[model samples]
Target: MNSIKPKFINVLFSSRLIEVLEFILEEPKTKKEIEKTLKISTSHLAQVLSKMVDMGLVDKRGDIVKILPKGEFILGVNRVAKGYDEFLSRFGNFMNTYILDDIPEWLISRFYELAEIEIAERREDVFSPHPEFFEHLSNSKRIYGYVTVFFKECINFFLRLAEEGREMEIIVNKGVLDKIVENFTEGFGKGIERKNVRFYVSKKDFQVFFYCYRCFLFDILLFKKCFFLTTRKIFFANLGWVIVPNSKSFIKAIKKYAPDKLEEVIK
Candidate 1:
């Protein structure tokens, strides 16, 4: 219906309108109830509702404000736009270094599922992970991620998780698999040889590192811990955060990158 035409930009920024529509999306609402629930003054809400009607997004059937089909369309558009906006607002700095090309379209449309993102960074040492991240992660029973940068310590850290009986799956590009076999020759052959740890090698090269546990999803920056692997230039990843702990959004993205399609790395 061309609901996301140029003029829709204004609709995306109308927080009051978004709030009203989201509140009443399932049903209709009375004017007084909206004003009270939104804590908006009568005069302000009057103006907001008036604007909504003028845009043909809503209709006043007596005292109740009802969303029109057009309004539903606008709200849906705003939801997707809001997802991209939130994602960029959080990781915009990585644009120069990383690209989202590896991520597929079906998943990008559902980015809003990642709720309440909180950033946790490691300020003391760029080479190490934040201690608190490890603490929170200890409670998780399963861990899986796509790693582009190969660090023996990082590999060992995850190996320990497997040793402790936590199920582990580490996906990587061929570049990394080669390096692990080449560099950690003796150790890789022995430890990850356990049935608990499974590795996958992707057919495509991915710059963005994606990680998640059963507890939370984490989009991580690479830590500069090795150059022995294929000479792929890597940025130091000293920052990572909980992405809506226990949220389903990242599971989709993690699945998009990992799964039955990739080659399993067998020791």
Candidate 2:
């Protein structure tokens, strides 16, 4: 007698499997209810359900079919994988050099959330800040940003925002913070001293940068070694931006890299 092989291939090839899982995602359903709702015959439903059970995807007790934890996990993985694939397709070339591990596993698991992000790139006028970056900054009442590689224009832009009385919280690598203090002494004093702005100097090196505007998450990859939040360094502003319900999650993930008591930069 031959040993039985896993039924994942059968599950993968069957669209009915997804339909069944999704349909039962919220609550358990009866076999007859699934067959009626999905418009599948008794035989077809039987086959899909059997394979789902064998694959540890669902628990079927008589006619009551319920999704197991494994089933829910597979569903989540399927969605995130599609998003990650899309990201890889466009920026996958950099996958070799950039440290994917720099991203927390939770964020990686949620990459699908950013699969269809809006991109803002300033191609024609490379000298100006990214057009969308400016638009968001101008419109936003609040801003949260993390800077990895800095540009003079980017720092100046925030200084101007500070002057406008915009509420802003900034985190930067300690090295970049030093450069700002040394290069822009008077401007830094004026901008940073404002009560509306808060600055934190992170001891850890910036692995990936993000600029959060109006509770939005922004990312732009300049090179394998650098992830720029917003900058005029390349003379063009190209941002990978997304707004999701859990925008705070991205902010929280980045803040974890900072020290328990974030060192405030006093100009």
> Which segments of model 1 are wrong by more than 4 Å?
1-5, 106-110, 116-267
lDDT of each: 0.61, 0.62
Return the lDDT, model 2, position 33.
96
Taking the tens digit of each residue's C-alpha lDDT, what string does model 2 give over 39-100?
Answer: 99999889888888988999999889999999998887666556767767866765575555
Q: Model 2 misses residue 253 by how many Å? A: 29
Residues 1-267, candidate 1: write the lDDT tens digits: 656668667888989889998888899999999989999999998899998999898998889999999999998888778787887887566566555553434334444565344343323234455445465457667665555545555666665677788766666677777878897777777767788766667666644344332332344322322111011222222223232334333344444535543665574
State, as a TM-score between 0 and 1, how close model 2 is to the true structure: 0.42
Which stretches of candidate 2 lie above 4 Å from their native place?
Answer: 1-13, 96-110, 120-237, 240-267
Quantify how close model 2 is to the true structure by its C-alpha RMSD in Å: 13.3
